[model samples]
Target chain A: MITTSIESVPGRKIVEQYGIVQGSTVRAKNVGVDCVAGCQNTFGGELKGYSQLLEESRAEALDRMIQQAEQKGANAVINVRFGTSTITQGASEILAYGTAVLVQ
Target chain B: MENLIGLIFTVGLIVVAYFVGKTIENRHFEALKAREREFLDLPSLTTQHSYDEEGIQDCRLVYGNVVISGDYFKMVLAALLKFFGGRIVGYESLIDRARREAILRMQAEARQFGADAVINTRFEMSKLDAMTQNQGTGMFEILVYGTAIKVNHG
Candidate 1:
């Protein structure tokens, strides 16, 4: 399949549209990691743990967005954008969206 | 005297252990990044065909999914841990990376087919299910598919 970004992929023809194709997962922390993280802050150089966390979430959200487009029989997605929100203090949600289209 | 000595030793031990563990984790993360870079750097293979004499070409390409399952699991765990503290994880990077890689592959395929643009792209994901009694393993699939077209530059 061909995939194109909203800005890079040209043409206005949309063959199919999928309404809010979304995928989400919720997570909770283990006490062990937290206790350790708290201690590391004093001498911290980099928060590698948190960096890895965000990377994973972003991939999951994008995977869901692509799944949605495929289900709609779309050849490509255009004008893709992402949004994130905190469900609580440490918990967050990532969302990806785009317009499903077919170019003639 | 003994209590003071023990407390200091315990704190020192915890601090040391924390750094060691973090270093190991960081090393693994770096390895993952390297793998991702290698995957993206591989040349994209494309195929194209033309329909009608108007110089319009139709193209299709396949892209392999980079399933970072280990990283994903870690991030989820981290987010859960942070929930109590009210800090959220930034997930945009992962999504953006996946999208970018997929698009690049598509474009490469279009170019291979001698097409100027790609049209009608679709993505899909499949998860594997295992039957406990039968001992059958299932496979998860993620796919990005699209058509490429060549048009007049003017």
Candidate 2:
């Protein structure tokens, strides 16, 4: 499936609109990684553990959104946007939303 | 004697952190500049869409994410500056490096996909360690995403 953040695909025409499709995931870092990150903060630089964790979470959220688009019988998802918010002390939520459309 | 020892220790830690953090920051900025120049040909724009879609061959989504933390020395320096209500140069450079690195990564991805340009680029920044905003790590995450398009020349 084609997924882009613009209103229309470059070479495809939107034949039908399937409204909005969304996916979200709540993720928390494990205690072990969190502890390591806490220590790394002292030295200060890139937090590799946290970056990897967030990347995985984002991929999962995007996958879920793509699944939703497939279920809706849409061949493409456009105008995609991501949202993130801290839910608690250790957990955060990532959301992917976009308009599903049939392209030809 | 105990108070004097504690003062010495705190100062020692800050001094060590200052040297180490500055070295890392300088190295990172150099690397970012080099990679940015490498991807200079691939333009990324904030417009909603490309103006010339007729010559485009394919389009897809691309993104880059990074998380960076301020060193102990900068955290302390920023806290001190908070009292004077002035700019925190340390954290400013930290965020600047993060943003440039993120865009470079995005451009690299577009290059891998054989995309000529990226459109509708957006950035999102958030605090990763929200629980300890003041006392703990000054950490933040930067995410940049856009639609990459392959343009047909012939």
Candidate 3:
């Protein structure tokens, strides 16, 4: 299914609206990655480990959102938005949500 | 005698950290300035729609993120600022770097699709390395994302 953060798809027409579809996931890295991130923090630069973790969680959350849209028989999702919240010391939640629609 | 040595070591580390961290932050700023000039041509907006002459051919989601942490000196300075109740100048650069880098990366991704503009641009700030909000000064990630759209010239 096509997805865009903008309310309307560029060249497509929305024929039906399926309300809102959402997906969320909690993710964490291993202890080793955490330790490495701590060391990198001392130097104050990019944290590669955490970047990868965020990428993974973001993709997963989007994927689940797409699944929800598909279940609702939507061909696309629009106005998609993402949010992240730290759950604890070693885990965080990534949430993706959007309005599912049938597009032509 | 032992207390004097401890103080010396802390001071020495802070001094070294000041020099090294400033240099790194300066370099990042320079790089971001160069990129900002390039991105000016690629229109990016926070509104959900683009106001350009609308012959949009394609639209897709695009996102970029950058994670940065504090050096020894910044952490120490922030600790002092916590008591003083003022802005932490050291961390000011860190956030600036993360934000600029994130936007640039997002622009790079949009370019891959030959998109000339991005609309409904939104930013999300979060933590990295699985750190909770209560944790001490730790790594934070800045994410810039939007709907990348390619317009047809015809």
Candidate 4:
């Protein structure tokens, strides 16, 4: 399936509208990673552990959204957006939402 | 005696953090500049859609994100500046670095996917401070995403 952040795919025409589809996931890293991130924080640099965790969670959220679009019989998802929120010291929530539509 | 020891420890921590943080920030900025030069020709735009539909062969979503934290010295400096109600240069640079790094990563992903350009790019920046409550280590997460498109050469 085609996915884009723009309102419409570049060369495709929207033939059907399936409304909005969304997916969200709350994820956390292990204590070991969190400990390393805490040390990195004190030194003021990239928190590589946290960055990886967030990226994995975001991909999972996107996959879920794609599955939803597939269930809706849509060929593409457009105007995608992402939202993030920290839930606790080691966990975060990532949400992906977009409009699902059929294209030709 | 106890108060003197505590004061020395605090001062020493700030001194070390200041120098170390400066070095890291400088190195990061240099790296960003070098990588940006490498992707100078790959356009990353905020436009909602690809302008030339006929020239594009395929497209897919690509994204990059990063989590960065302020050093102890920056937190201390920002705290002091908060009292005076003026600009906080420390935090400003932190955000700037995170923003550029995120974009660079996105562009790198597009390159890996063999895409000519990225369109409809969007940025998301948020504070991860709640997770580090009372630690005074300001944390931020920056995410950038876009549609990477492969253009027809012929």
Candidate 5:
């Protein structure tokens, strides 16, 4: 599926707009990462574990957005956006939303 | 004796962190530079929505997201600089790394579609690990998305 942030897609014409489709997930830090991160904070540098967690969570959210678009019979999702929020001290939510459209 | 031992342990850990973190950062930067050079031909942009709106042939939405964690040393430096109330170069590098990396990733995705350029590119950056308000323990995530388009080469 082709998607773009611009209102219009290049080459193909947007035949129909399916409004907005979205997906979101809330993730908590793993215990192992928490323990290691707490200790690593004293030495400060890249925490690989947390980076991995964030990446996975983000991909999950994006996947859901695509799935919703698919269900809506959209060939593409445009103007995709990612949002984040700290729901609690231990968990954070990742949200991906976009416009679904059928392109021809 | 116990206090001395604790001091040694703390210092040793920070020193280890300094070297380890520096190595990782340097390596990531090196990779970023090399890839950026490879993408010199594909120009990504923020304006000029349709790639030749008149003769546009095909377009697709492509995106990339990256999350990078600040090293302990940078965090510690930021904490120290907080008292001086000045620019924190240490944290700046963290932001720069995430930003550049995210853009590079988006470019890579464009390349997959054989796109000559990406249009209307946008970025979203946030702290993924900002559990503690005043603490230096936080992770930065940068998400970049754009439309990859190929226009006829006239």
Candidate 6:
């Protein structure tokens, strides 16, 4: 599959337009990571615990997106972007989106 | 003497607990980093194309919702002991890690399709309300989508 951030793929051409293929995910934080993160203020440093939590979440979410594109038989995804919003004071969401297409 | 002994014991316990927790957290972080490295290391190339040339490809990728939940009661207690602070710091790092992982996965997928570049990528996040209310359990959905193009920069 050929994926890019731009609208068009260079060198090769997009033979078929596969409409709009997308992947989305909603991840919630566990209580343990939150509690450790809450205390990070006093200790000050890297919250390795929460860092790992987010990493896992992001991976899982992207995996779903890729699966969706694959289902459509897309050769690539392009124009990938990410957005994050705080659902609450202690919680937030990260989304990744892009275009799925087949190029030759 | 009794007061001194009690204080010493309490301090010792706290110290031991802190070390143990740190060790566990470090291990988890290491594992995550390894996974991230593997994803990013995948062979992939990036390219850009113009709309006039190929028209609107309109490609999208939707990932299954992955929910990861954990409780940091000890950390919360520690934060409470010191006062409600450092939440932002924790959040910043957490978000950063999450974004990186999402990007890596997208890149890997792009590579699989032989795409040199990805364009117009976007991300979305939401909270899992049904899961937890008080502890702030939320879901972060990363949707990395864009136009996969093969461009000739020559």
Predicted candidate 4 versus true structure: per-residue lDDT over B17-111, tens digit per residue: 89999999999999989999999889899885446787788899999999999999998898899999989999889899999999999998999
Query: Of the pair 1 and 2, which is ahead by DockQ?
Result: 2
Clashing pairs in 2: none
RMSD of each: 12.9, 1.6, 2.2, 1.5, 3.0, 8.9
Off by over 4 Å in 1: A1-5, A8-20, B1-154
Residues B14-97, candidate 5: write the lDDT tens digits: 677778877867887898899899999987898855456766667777777665666656666778899999999867876787
- Return the lDDT, model 4, position A72: 100
Q: Could you arrange the candidates by DockQ from highest to lowest? A: 4, 2, 3, 5, 6, 1
- DockQ values, each candidate: 0.04, 0.68, 0.61, 0.71, 0.48, 0.13
Candidate 3: lDDT of B152? 84
lDDT of each: 0.46, 0.87, 0.83, 0.89, 0.77, 0.52
Give the per-residue lDDT digits (tens) of candidate 6, residues A1-104. 54445555544577776666555555566788656655542233344565456556666656676788889888776655555555655556656567777877
Writing each residue's lDDT as its tens digit, candidate 6 over B1-154 gives 9999998886765666556545654664676688766655332223233333544333433221222222243444546755755554434444454555556666666666565445555555544333334443223433334444334333
Q: Give me the displacement of residue A75 in model 1, in angstroms.
A: 1.9
lDDT of 1 by residue, B19-71 (tens): 66446445645655665564453333232222232554333333334222123
User: Whose DockQ is higher: candidate 1's or candidate 6's?
Assistant: 6
Q: Which ten residues in a row have the lowest lDDT in candidate 3 chain A?
A: A37-46
As for candidate 4, its clashing pairs are none
Better of 3 and 5 by TM-score: 3
The digit string of per-residue lDDT tens for model 2 on B46-80 reads 99654588888888999998888988899889888
Ranking by TM-score: 4, 2, 3, 5, 6, 1
Q: How many residue pairs clash in each candidate?
A: 26, 0, 0, 0, 11, 102
TM-score of predicted chain B, candidate 2: 0.92
lDDT over C-alpha atoms for residue B146 of model 6: 47
Candidate 5 chain A, run of 10 with poorest lDDT = A39-48
iRMS, model 3 (angstroms): 2.6
Leading candidate by lDDT: 4
- Candidate 2, residue A80: how far the Cα is off, in Å: 0.5
